[model samples]
Target: MKKLISMIAVAALLITGCAKELKVTTAENLKVEYGEELDNTKLFNAKESDENVKVDKVEGFDAKKMGEQEITVTFTDDNKDKEEKLKITVEDTKKPVIELKKESVGITAGDKLELKDNIKSVKDPVDGDLKYSDKTVEKDGYYIDKGKLDTKKAGTYEVKVIAADKNGNKTEKSFKVNVKKKETAKKPNGTGNSNTSNNGGSSSSNPSNTGNSGSNTGSSSGGSNNSSNSNGGLSNNGGGQKPVNPAPHQHSITVTGYPDVVYSNMWFEDDTEAMYWASNYEGPNGDWAGFGYSSDQCSCGMWSPYFFNVTTWE
Candidate 1:
């Protein structure tokens, strides 16, 4: 029985005087191929013996040579009479590696994200299925897909990406996202007010023409100090009569009019008709005496006529 059989010398064809006989004995019929190895045992289709057992030239491929490689196989008969060989090649049919590009991102609400980096451009050692996330946000030349990230809400969020090839190779990565909050603007004066028209209807412009709010007291400027009212005081468009006085309405007047401010002594609105009272004091009966709006400049002085009647008594 010859154990180590290889391509060897062939006997010459015997020839007679008139004719010649060629002896071409066919070697055992065998097949061979190489493929990626799996973690578990694998079975290759080869001719089997009558006992249903594999009787090929090779037993099995070594797991270590799982990558692209070449395998040699031979087949022989039970009598160990002759043998033949076949060469097979194994290769990886999986795409290259994929990973996250950017590690972190900071953005405000209503902002969109672009996961361009992590998207796999392409890797080597491939042949079979090479596909990216179908659910990704595709753009001009980028594939953007995230596991868990919503920018609408205000808070920190995390985004992750995963990729796998047909060969069962997998890769995953993540990112940090910071979202900003929205803000609203506020009015300067800190108050909202409008006045009525002559016919007591809503008017775009309030004819009342107030000097502002706080403690203010002053006589009429250019306009007639006294109008045709029951009381010789400035009159509302309604013909209502109210006396205008020059008494300071508030203790302190933060006048935006003058470059400088008039922080009067607290006693300004306190003494006699004075409306100033450092501590909270309504009045001998009701609220304060003459305090209402900021002091408006008048020929007489700074005073708010609209506050209380300038004439008559308290």
Candidate 2:
């Protein structure tokens, strides 16, 4: 009976030694793409030569959500069971996001249309460096489909902008470009007249009265000097009509002796120096001429005629 017990123990030890052990050959930490299924066969080490050896169960792993997951792999060999627990990481499956900088922009007609300038920027959560492109909706007179603007007609237009990533994920945005007519420049000041006088001539009705001065000197019968008077005038409106807008011109005049200047109450008189304005001096009237006044009006005052170039607006 003792010998029979010894033989039974030896048989049990041989059976236990022949049984195969299950193991996982894959890495302890596995990474899988989102929305992908995990294969149990690839995660386990089973002897393909043995028909009874097979992957029995795989659980505790999900690829739908992005995070760390626990995966339990089990192998069965002839009713023997073994299990392996490991960690896996699931990544996002969604595409990148994109948006427009602005919904609309305004520009004048005949201006260059820079397509890229309108887009604020292209961004992606997973893919930071995204590809971008733009296109015009139509080949209309108001909008340019691409490149520099070719059309100048005033009208509203639309453009499509696209942002894409290497994963074939893409997003689109729309923009409205407004083309408007260009405005013209306005003339300086209002409708007024400019008439200037030269020498001792009196200014009647004149507009655009620039700087001008005039003076008159009287003489006594015995060659003695009489009292002198100075006059200056500025008129913005001349003769109730638009004053002649003269083109810019200049000329000079010389006097050997003082010439008597005719005075008018319409002008302002100065005891010392008088200012002459080209706008009020009609003597030069659309013609080039200069007006002169006494630099200093003493008891014996000297005066001379002045000349300057003049131009008239048509």
Candidate 3:
């Protein structure tokens, strides 16, 4: 009988020792972007008795809502229910998108041009289509940065467009505006005149006294005639018009030695023009080298020294 009691006690002890408890491990806090759906597979890990367990469902979390919220996760282990609590935060960190109709726009000089005409749309995932704002300080719409747009000049100008969502998420993009010179009409040629004058007289009178030398004393009259003609020639070399100089040829310089520094479609009208533009180039992040051309060699260096060759085209 004591052996039987000992066996029963041993069995009970073994059963108690073999019993397992559900254990769940999860992050204390989760961060997600606005409009992102919650994914359960990435949330936590659950196991019981060295075996995997299944999550039944999750509660107390809304994906659409922004800000911090308490979340409760539920799972099942060995036909038993369990719950875990954590915090989730949904934020609007994504920037708005600015779509442009064209990367570069062309207009004649002295013509009216609106910056908004280049923009196709400005959209935010949460705020829909953004409106246009003249005030640069506003947060919910798009505005042009502080810069002058001179359509009266014939050159390339950069236009910066900034967009912001309702949550203060901002985006910036730029496009080029190429202003061209206007065409002029040509004038017609002028006419020239010529004049001629003739002053001459001829008289044929048979001088009978000439044959007879005796009467040579008769009165003899002689008259001389002169004729003059003046003709004016009009020369219309190019119709007295000024020669039209060709437009400034564009030259592209190839940059080398620096992989991090990138240049856009940049060109120079001439050596002087290139130096001037490079001197004024502000770069993308205020760290850029001004371009210089000397002795048929083109190079740029600010953060680091780099070299490039100049290519000319009409």
Top model number, lDDT: 3
CA lDDT of 37 in candidate 3?
81
TM-score winner between 1 and 2, please give it: 2
Stretches of candidate 3 above 4 Å error? 1-21, 47-50, 125-127, 184-314
TM-score order, best first, reads: 3, 2, 1
lDDT for residue 95 in candidate 3, whole number 0-100: 88
Q: Which stretches of candidate 2 lie above 4 Å from their native place?
A: 1-8, 14-93, 133-151, 186-314
Candidate 3 per-residue C-alpha lDDT over 213-232 given as tens digits, one digit per residue, 9 for 90 to 100: 45533424333213323323
> Estimated TM-score per prediction?
0.31, 0.33, 0.52
Best candidate per TM-score, number? Answer: 3
How much does candidate 3 score in TM-score?
0.52
For candidate 2, write residues 196-279 as lDDT tens digits.
243324455545443332223222455533322232232323224534679853322233454544232122223211222212
Candidate 3 lDDT score relative to the true structure: 0.63
Candidate that beats the other on TM-score, 2 or 3, i.e. the better one: 3
